[model samples]
Target: MIKLQNVEKVYRTSSIETLALNNINLDVKKKEFISIMGPSGCGKSTLLNIMGLLDAPSKGQIEIDGSKVENYNDKDLAHLRNQKLGFIFQSFHLINDLSVIDNVEIPLLYRSSTAKQRRDLAQEALEKVGLSNRMKHFPKQLSGGQKQRVAIARAIVGKPEIILADEPTGNLDSVMGNEILGILQKLNEDGATIVMVTHDDAMAKKTHRLVRLFDGTQVM
Candidate 1:
C-alpha cells in the first residue's frame, strides 16, 4: 500500500545542510505490520513523516495506495492524508480542553459527515481501543495508558488504511507500553496497515518485519 524509491530528505539553511534520509527504498504491503528501528539521528521519524505525507522528500518518489504523492498539491495531499493515513505519536497529542470523544471526532470534522455520524464513528473507535468508558474524560483525567488509547482511537476514527506511529511507547512504563502494543496488535489483526518507529529492540521484534537504519540509510 506504500512505496518509496530512492528517497532523500535534506534540511538546508544558509550555512547548514543535514541529510535526514538517503537513498531510501521501502515498500509496505496492505495490512502488514512493519517496525523501523534505529538510533538517534538515523531518520526513522523522518521516514515516518514522509510516509504519512506530513513532510516531503527532497528527492525521489512516494506512492500511497498506487497514487504518486511526491508532487501532490496541498489540498490534494491533505485530503489523501485524511482519507488514507492515521498517526499515533509518543506524546499522545490529545487536546487537553476536549473530552476524549471530542478529540476522536476532531479528524472527522474535516469530512462531510454529520455530527451524529461523527459521534458514532468516534464511539466505535473508542470501543475498538477499549476506551469507551473514558469517552467523557479529559486527557489529564486519564492514565498514561488510557491517554494513549484515546490517541489510538483518534487515529483510527477516520477508518484510514494506514497508521504511522512514532515512538508510541516512548513515554509509558513497561506495563502500559505492553498494553499499548497489544492494542496495536489487535488493530493490525483487524487489517490496519501499521508502520511504527521504535527504539526498543523487543518492541521491534514483535512486529512482522523490522527495517533498521543508520546514518540516514536503511541498513537492513
Candidate 2:
C-alpha cells in the first residue's frame, strides 16, 4: 500500500549537512504489520515521517496506494495525510486540557461531521482501547498506559488506511508495553496496515517483518 524508492533525506544548515536516510527502498503491502528497529539516531522516525507524508524526502519518490506523491503543495499534502494516514508517538501528544474523548474527537473536527457523530466515533475508539469509562478523564488524571491508549484512540478515530506509530510503547513499563503491543496486534488482525518504529527486540519480533537500520542505512 506504500512504496518508497531510492529515498534519501538530508538536513542542511549553513555549516553542516546531516543525512538522515540513505537510499531507503521499501514496499509495504496492504494489511501487513512491519516494525523498524534501530539504535538512537538511526533515522527511524525520519523514515516514518516520510512514509506518513509529514516530511518529504530530499530525494526520491513516494507512492501511496498507487498514487505518486510528487511536488504536492502544502494544502494537498495535508489533505492526503488526513485521508490516508494516522500517527502515534512515544509521548502521548494529548492536550492536557481536553478530556480523553474530546482528544479523540480532535481528528474528526477537521472533517465535515456533527458533534454527535464525533462523540460516537470517539466513544467507539475509546472502547477499542478499553478506555470507554475514562472518556471524561483528562490526561493528567490517567496512568502512562492509559494516556498512550488515549493517543492510540485519537490516531484510529479517523480510521485511516495506514497507521504510522513511532515508538508507541516507548514510555511504558514492560507489562504496559506488552499490553500495548497486544492492542496493536489486534488492530493489525482487524485489517489496519501498521508501521511501527521501536528499539525493543521483543516488540519488533511480534510484527510480521522486521527491518533493521544502522546509522541512516537499511542494513537488514
Candidate 3:
C-alpha cells in the first residue's frame, strides 16, 4: 500500500548538513503491521513521517496505494494525507480545552459532515477505545493510559488506510503500554495497515515485521 524508493532525508543549515535517512527502500503491503526499531537519532521517526506525508524526503519517490506522490504539491499532499493516513504520537496531541469527544471529532472537521454525524462517529471511536463513558472528560482529567486511548480513538475515527505511530507507547507504564499494544494488534487484525516506530524489543516483536535502522541506514 506504500512504497519508498531510494529515499534520503537531509536537514541543511548554513554550515551543517545532517543526514537523517539514507537510501531507505521500504514497502508496506496492505493490512500489514510493521515496526520500525532503532536507537536515538537512528532516523526511524523521519522515515515514518516521510511515509505518512507529514514530511517529504529530500530525494526519492513515494508511492501510496499506487500513485507516485513525490511531486505532489502542498495542497495535493494534504488532501492525500487526510484521505489515507492517521497518526498517533508519543505525546497525546489532544487539545486540553476540548472534551474527549471533541478531540476525536477534530479530524472529521476537514470533511463535509453534520455536527450530529461527527458526534456519532466520535462516540463510536471512543467506544472502540473503551472510553465511551469519558466522552465529556477533558485531557487534564484523564490518566496517562486514558489519554493515550483518546489519542488512538482520534486517529482511527477517520478510518485511514495506514496508521503511522511514532513511539506510541513511550509515555506509558509497562502495563499500560501492553494494553495499547493490544489495541494496535486488534486494529491490524481488523485490516488497518500499521507502521510503528518503537524502541522496545517486546513491542517491536509483536508486530508482523521489524525494520531496524542505524545511522540513517537500514541495518536489518
Candidate 4:
C-alpha cells in the first residue's frame, strides 16, 4: 500500500511560483484500483510522479509500505522505483529500434538477471497483454493499441506491486480503449494495485474509487 500525508508540490522559478498539488492526503489500499480525474493543468500527473517517487514533494511526506521516503537516499529511491513500482505513461515510451519483446525487456536491464530470464519474463508479460504473436514486430509496425499493450507489458515485466499509469487510454479509439481498460481491470483483479490518471468519466467510474482534483487541490 502507498500513503501520502499532507503532500504539497511547488515549482518555483526566479520570479514565478506554481502550486502543483495542495495538501493532498491519500491512502491506497492493497489491490485497490483508484482513478484520478482533473483538468489539463490540475496536477494529476504531478501527484502521480510524487507517488511513484520520481519527484520529491516540497512540503510533505511519502510513505511506501511502511518506510518514510524522506529517509531514503538516491540509491534507495532507485531500488524502490525499480523493484517496487511499475509505470505506464499515456504515450508509449517504447524504443522504435527494439523489437517488441526487447522493448518489454528494457526494465529488466536495470536488474541483475540473465538474458534467458529477461526473455522469459518478457515473453510472459507480452502474452498477458495478448501480444505474444507480435513479439518479433517493431513499434512502428504495430497499431496504437498494440503499442500501448507493449507499454503495459514493459511496465509489468518486473512484477512490481504498484502500477502507476498516466492517461493510459488517451491515445486510442473507444474499442481499443476498452480493451486496454479491461486489461488493467484484469490486472487489478489478479492483485496489482493501480492508480490511474484519466480525463474520461466512464473510465474513472470503473475503478473502485475516484479522486477528483481542481486547481491542484483534492476537491472530492
For model 4, what is the error of residue 27's alpha carbon versus the real structure, in angstroms, after optimal superposition?
0.3
List model 1 lDDT by residue over 1-220, tens digit each: 9999999999999999999999999999999999999899999999999999999999999999999986689999999999999999999999999999999999999899999999999999999989899888999999999999999999999999999999999999999999999999999999999999997889889999999999899999
Q: Model 4 segments beyond 4 Å from truth? A: none
For model 1, name the residue pairs that clash.
none
Q: What TM-score would every model get versus the actual structure?
A: 0.99, 0.98, 0.98, 0.99
lDDT of 3: 0.93
lDDT of 4 by residue, 26-113 (tens): 9999999999999999999999999999999998989987779998898999998999899999899999999999999999999999
Q: Which stretches in model 2 have alpha-carbon errors above 4 Å?
A: none
Q: What pairs collide in candidate 4?
A: none
lDDT of each: 0.95, 0.94, 0.93, 0.95
Which digits, one per residue and each the tens of the lDDT, describe model 3 over residues 1-220? 9999999999999999999999999999999999999889989889999999989999999999897996799999988888888999999899999999999999999989999999999998898889999999999999999999999999999889899999999999999999999999998998999999998999998899999999999988
Q: State how far residue 194 of model 3 sits from its true place (Å).
A: 0.1
The ten-residue window of minimal lDDT in model 1 covers 196-205
Top-lDDT candidate index: 4
Error of 4 at 93 (Å): 0.9
**Candidate 3: misplaced stretches above 4 Å?**
none
